[model samples]
Structure formats: C-alpha cells, structure tokens
Target: MRKNERLKGKTVVITGASGGLGEQTAYRCAASGANLVLLSRNVKKLEEMAESIREKYGVSSLALKLDISRHEDIPAVFRAIFEKAGHIDVLVNNAGYGIFAEAKDVTPADVEGMFAVNVVGLIVCTKEVIPSMRKRKSGHIINISSQAGKLATPKSSVYSATKHAVLGYTNSLRMELAGDGVFVTAVNPGPMATNFFDLADPSGNYVKNLGRHILSTEKVAEKVVDAMLTNRREINLPGWMNAGSILYAIFPRLVERLGKKAFFKK
Candidate 1:
C-alpha cells in the first residue's frame, strides 16, 4: 500500500462485494489503501477477491457472506464486522438489483424481491452503522441509487420506484444527521455494462437499444471511491443523462411527451 493516506487505515464496508459495481468499488478502495469489509452471498468469490486485494494492494480485507435481502442476517453480520474492525469509517450500501418489466406485467414477487434488497435491506444496513457512526461523530454512508430514480421510464416502473425510495431515504438521512459529523451521499448512475442487464433486461432489447449509453462499472466505481469520506450530496453519472433528468424534473409532462420513444426502449 506504501501508505496511500487517501483511505489508509480506513475501514470501508461494501455490500454486494462479489461482483459488478460492488466489486469494482472494492478494488478502488483497496488501491486507495482502505481496509475492506466485503459482504456478499458469494463467499468463495469474495474470499478470492480479498486475497487478490491483499496480495496486490497490501491491505487487509474480510470477505463475509452476506445476503442483504435477508434482513434478519444483517444484524449478526454487522455485529461480526464491528467486532473485527473495531469501528467502521464508511459504509457503502451497494447491494441491489432490478428487473425491467411493464407495470401491468410486473408481479408481486418482483416488487417484493427488489424492494427487499434495494430499499429495505439498504435501510437495515444503514441503520446498523448509524449508532457507531453517530457515537464517533465521524463516518460516511454512501447509497448506490440510480439515474432511473430521477427519471422514470417505461418498463422500469418498479425499479425506478426502488431507486427513488433510496434517494428519498438518503436525503432525509443526510438532514437528520446534520448535528452529527456522519455524512450521507447518493450515487445515481445510468445503466452499466454488467450482469445487471442479464436480469434487468433479460430479453436484451434494452441494453441493445442503450448501446454506448451504457456506462462502465469501473468509471462509476472510480467516481464513487473518489467521493469517499467527503460530504458529497450526489454523484450522477454521464453528464448528459443527468442533464436530461434535470430537465425532466422541471417539465415532466414535456419530457414525457417528447421522450416517449426513448422512454419505451425497454
């Protein structure tokens, strides 16, 4: 590590650390010299990544089996984390997924499943770290929201709802912790080149239509790691898309009327 000082000695806990943005963000944190608590259901892969990080970056890491959707498991998992790490410096609630389907086609199971991991589970994880962070009056909670949160489109109603909830929660949490030094941030990224589309757009039509608009997980992860420990409010990816979101916010009906075709790409 050669004492990178950036996040050296900082304990960063990242959920969904087995792959996708979670995995990429972990590497960025390691490269920045942060000790890691990598949580995901894939213990084997997590351990392999931990070993790789230790060997490559000379930073210690703990790969824990955590299925964030299983809310009951979170408390015990976080207990083990605090016991081992003594205290957490940052918490990244990145364990989430989505499926693209029209509102009429979406099932109750789909809604329940996505909310379990994307919204409820994130809240549980954030809650687990609050007392510790508040007690120390120092920490950061970064919620991995999505650009879909800002602009709802066709065939993604449920997914957008979840991300919207994340943004709402993140905003309220940041305000609530104002007296405390703990900071909260929301990362709103557009679609990315990851297995997320494997499920979100199983038919592949959406990703095909998205084309170059799809972001690289590495790019999004770098932006996220760069904002670590800072009181950054939001990290929205792909300036153009975020700009569209801004436009959508003010003239929702106009954007919807004009973007009907683009919104139906799903």
Candidate 2:
C-alpha cells in the first residue's frame, strides 16, 4: 500500500472524533479516501470537521452527537450510521479521558466516570459491530489503550486500571475473532501534546514536568491511520517508553524500584 492510501474506499467509525488523536485520525482517514462517521458530544465541532473533510478530501462523512456512557443510546446512534454507510469496515474506539490525582484524593465519581467511558463504552461499541463483521468475515477494531495500562504510574491509578481492562478485553476479543477475519489492535502511548491534559492534569504540573517526552497527536494518528485494514496487533508509540513498559511487564519489582522517581513525575 502507498503511504496514506491503505484505507481507501473504507467506511470508518471513530469515537471521540471531535478532538485529540481521534479527530486527527479522522482527517487522515478522509485524506486516504475513506468515508467517515465521527461521534462525540461536541456535535458542532464534529459537523464542522465532517464538512471540512468533505470539501478538502472529497470524502463523504457524518457527524453524530453521542456520549457512549449512555449505553442505551449507542445502538440507535450506530443504526443511523449503518443506514448511511451500509456497513462499517473499521471501528476505532478512541474516546476516553483521565484525571491525574493521588489515589487517596480520587473520588468514587472519578472512578465511575472513567470506567464508564474507557472500559464499558468501548466494549459496548465493540459488541455492536462484531456481529456484522463476523458475518462478513472482515473488520478491524482498534482500541486506544494507554501506557498507563501496562505500567501503572503514581497518579494514574484509576485511568490505568481502566486501560488495563481495555487491554485484557482487546486481547481476548482478538483471539475469539481471529477465525472470523476481524483484526483487533490496542494502541498504547505515553503522554501526548494535546488538550487531554486540560482536564487530565488541570494543574498543568504533569505536562510541564513531562515536556518533550510527550508524543505528537498528529504523528500518532498517522500511525493509526496507516495501520487500518491490516493484521497489526499493537501500535505502541515512542520506542523508549514502550521499552520501559516491556521491562515493567517482565521485571515488575526491579523496574518499580528503579523507576520510582520517574513514575512520580505526575
């Protein structure tokens, strides 16, 4: 496949697509000739992006207002998308957020909110598409997990837990669907240069401390767009960070002892 041409003529559904990596990936996919269904709570912004891509890339797109936490509303939103796109070829579960705070300060509400969007919402969307994809024997499900899922950090307890759940879910889902020709992937990236920290680290301390190490949303989105329609298993950004995660997975105690200062950056 040529650069930026892998997803040509495919129908892609992206959640939280009004901003962050999700939005960037949508634009890149459109540039590659894919029709799009962009879902997010920010309907105004989503509509603007869809119209802009239609003009610039000449690709058809739809902006659907949705909050996946409202599980009851998910089925209907997807039904409307299928009505227009016929059938989805790719589903990117890229909608999630985090709050950075010490565990003792974390509230029940925070835990509930994060899990609702990060874990349950992703599973619900995946469930909605699996049946049709299985019937057709072809599809791609990309879950936007995080480095926190692999290596738990000081202030990322709840967020990391949710991502861990995503990893487990994606791994098992991949095994079950491999015979059906559905490719499942998990994207684990470290901090990013995005407004994600606007809410995640409202104090701005985390971003300030982790400057330069933060990954670029556009670059990461390009990687994601490039991996579409392929048998890729995982897209872990910034080789160095993923290396640390691999070490942590193998030598938990030793890495934890040696990385205490770094882990407390937040």
Candidate 3:
C-alpha cells in the first residue's frame, strides 16, 4: 500500500494530545486521514483540540479526559475508546513528564510522580493494547523517549531513568512482537520548542542555554508520523544530538568527562 494510504481510516490513539508533541502528532495523523482518539487530563482542552482536528482534517476524532499516571483509570478509558472507535491501529504513548533536580534533591513524590507517568503509565497502556494487536496480528506502538534516555545528564537523572526504562521496554517489546506483526518504535528527540521545559526546568536555564539547538514540535511530529507510516524502528532527531548517544555508548567515561562541565553548569 502507498504511504498515505497506510493511515487512511486507521484508528490512532494518542495520550497527552492536549498540547505539545502529542497535539502535533494528532494533527499529522488527522491530515493523513486517521481517526484520532485524543486523550489528556484536561477534558475541555482535549475536546476543543479534537473538534478542531475533525473540522480541519475531515477525520473523525474522540477526546477523552485521561490521567495516564493513574494506572487504575486506563482500562476504563481504553474500553470507552474501543467501544467508540472499534480498534486502534496505532498507539502513541506520548503522555509523560520530567522533574529535573539533583538525584539527592528529588523528593519521594517527585520520583513516584515521574515514574507513574513515564514508566509505569506507558507500560500499562502498552499492555492494554497488546492483546488486541496480537489477535489481529498487526499494529504499531510508538513510544516517545528522549536523548536523556541514551545519555544521562546531571539534573535530569530521574527523568532520564524513566526514559531509559521506556527505551528498554520498547526494545524488548519490539522483539517479542516481531513475529506477531506488531511494530514498535522508539522516538528519541532532542529538546523541542514546547512547554515541557517550563515544568522540567522551571528556572529556565536549560531552555535558555539549549534553545538554539532545539527542534520545532512540528518538525519532530512529522518525523514521528513518517516513522509510523514507514515502520521505522527508531527515530533520533537532529542527527547531532543522536551522535551524542552513540558517543556515550562507545566512550562513556570520555564522553562524561567532556560533557560533565556543560551538563552540570548553571
């Protein structure tokens, strides 16, 4: 089938679709003729976004108020989606948050909150979708990780740990689902021009320092949608940032020595 034809009439469920990367990905998928199941904690915003997408792209969309961090809430939300949309051809685990603080400074709540949304939440969502995908023998699971997952920085230790867990899980899931015809992809993007940094780095230093190197949300979203349609296993944006991952893997100590100053600098 043709690339554009691949997503036409397909059902795509995206968590965190109220704004940022999730919102952008929803637009991209809608343009490709995919029916969108948009999930977010903010019901009003999600409904507004869904209406806009439906109007602009002429694709059907459903907005569900969801808190992915609340594992107990996922099953019912997904059940409603399945009842409304029938089946999901693509699942984007895009709802996650970060708390950037020194490992010692991060509170217990901080650790729990981050893991709840980033690691455990993603796993639960994946589990919810896997059985149906397995029975059908075709599906795509796109996980939005981060460059931090590949290379742990100073203040982003906990956030990086969560993403690393996501990367590890995605890799293992990919192999397990390979024979079952389910494609799993991990997207490791560098910083993007999004509000994520407002929460991740409230002091604004990280964004101020890295603003010039950041990718736009639209650019990253396009790449993500392309990966979905083309079945790419992994996507690392702004090649240079991805290079850092490679360097870290091959020369951890050397890379750390060179990066420590900048990574920890205020």
Candidate 4:
C-alpha cells in the first residue's frame, strides 16, 4: 500500500468494538498499523479482542467498557483517548443497536433506546471529538449507518428512523466542517449476519430472509478502512446496495405496497 493508503501510525477510536463489524474493523485497522481505542459495553469481550489484535498485529490497543446508550459516559472516554493518544486521528461511530418492530408494536422506550445509541450517542461522541479536530483542522469521522438509512423496511420503522437521522447528521456536519479539513463520512451497509438479529424482535422475519444475503463482517471492515483512507463521504457496500437506494428513491410507494403484499402472503 502507498504511504497515504496505509493506516499506519494513526490513532483511531472505534465504538461497538466488541463484535461483528466493530471487532473485524479493529483487527484490520491494527494490521494497517493504527493504534486502537476499542470501546464497548462488554468489557470481557473487549479485553479478549484487544489481546487478539495485539498478538496478531503487534499493535498497542486500549479497551474501554462503554455503553453508547448512556451519554454520560462520553466525556470520560474522550478524555482517556485524548490523554493517551494526544489526538484521535479517526473516530468510528459504530456502536449502535436496532429494534425491529412495526411502528404500532414499538414502545417509546424501545425507540428511545435505539436512538440513544444509533443517533444521539453518535452525535455526542462526535461533539466531544470535534474540538480537538477543529483545533488541528484535520480528522476523520466515520459513522456506521445501514441500508435502512436510505430506505424504510417493514418492522424496521424505529431502526430506520435512527439511521436516517445519522444520514442527515453526517451530511450536515460534513458541510459545516468542509473548510476546516475535517472529513465526515457515513458507511451504509445492507444485510449482515451478526448478533444484531438476536436483538431485533424475535417474531420478525426481517432478519431471516435478509440475513441470507449478508456480507462477511471482515469484508465490511475492509471497506470501512478503505473509505477512511480515500476520504469517501458516503459508501454503500457491495454495489447492489446503491441499486437499492436508487430503487427506493425512484419508487417510494412501491416498497410500502410490496411490503404489505408480502406481509399478507406470509
């Protein structure tokens, strides 16, 4: 890899670093020579993952037990990263949860909890990091959104809303920081086989069929790292996802109609 292409010697902070895309991205970033600050609510898993990265890539890493749902935890974690690394070159806001339920079936608490991690928490983390980035006039902020960010799917009403908020936030923030040299990007992925399904509504078939077309967690991580290096603004993995976006944009009512049809058939 070219010097600019390599993540070597950079300090990156990744939330939701315990499993799935976060875990895979941590390992890949370490291999590319980026020192990592991995944060997740699962302390034991985070420690184990940190050890694996160190052993394989010989890169130093720190694991912080974090619950992105709790906004109060942001300041302290940001302080630790700043103190330890002097500056955070990249911030990957990947720690988010999803709740799969029809709008009527969704409770207020369920919606609130998802937003706490998926939208508000991401915003809070970015807010905490921006002062440093603005001072230096350089940094990368990568948010892990979803295909649902671009289109709504049945039973994903609340989840879709949160991701859509992320999409809007990323765009607006990117523009505001454009001249400041702070790059803000959003990574929107389609179906992926992860424990995300385990957290979704149990009766929902959304995960069953969708998970069948899932991409590998490692592939998603690689794409994320590539996006960071290239300074991409918005990325939809696997190409077909862009097609999905186009389809949704061109045929808004089509999805709702087809969704209801599919529901009846089921």
lDDT digits (tens) for residues 67-97 of candidate 2: 9889899999989988889999999999999
lDDT, model 2, position 247? 94
Please state the error at residue 74 of candidate 1 in Å. 0.4
RMSD of 2: 1.3
Query: Model 1: residues >4 Å from true position, as ranges?
Result: 1-4
lDDT of 3: 0.90
Evaluated at residue 230, the lDDT of candidate 2 is: 94
Would you estimate the TM-scores of all the predictions?
Answer: 0.97, 0.98, 0.97, 0.92
Q: In candidate 1, what are the lDDT values of residues 74-106, reduced to their tens digit?
A: 999999999999999999999999988889999
CA lDDT, every model vs. true structure:
0.93, 0.93, 0.90, 0.84
Q: Which consecutive 10 residues in model 1 have the weakest lDDT in total?
A: 1-10
- Tens digit of lDDT per residue, candidate 3, span 125-222? 99999999999989999999999899888888899999999999999999999999899999999888889988988888888887588799998898
- Residues 1-266, candidate 4: write the lDDT tens digits: 21234578888899999999998888878878999999999989999988988898788899998899889989998998899889998999999878776689999999889999999999999999899998998899999999888977667888989999999999999999888888998999886777887787455565565555667787788788877745688878767766767776999688557556543321
Residue 230 in candidate 2, Cα distance off native in Å: 0.5
Clashes of each: 0, 0, 0, 0
After TM-score superposition, what is the CA distance of residue 133 in candidate 4 from its true location, in Å? 1.1
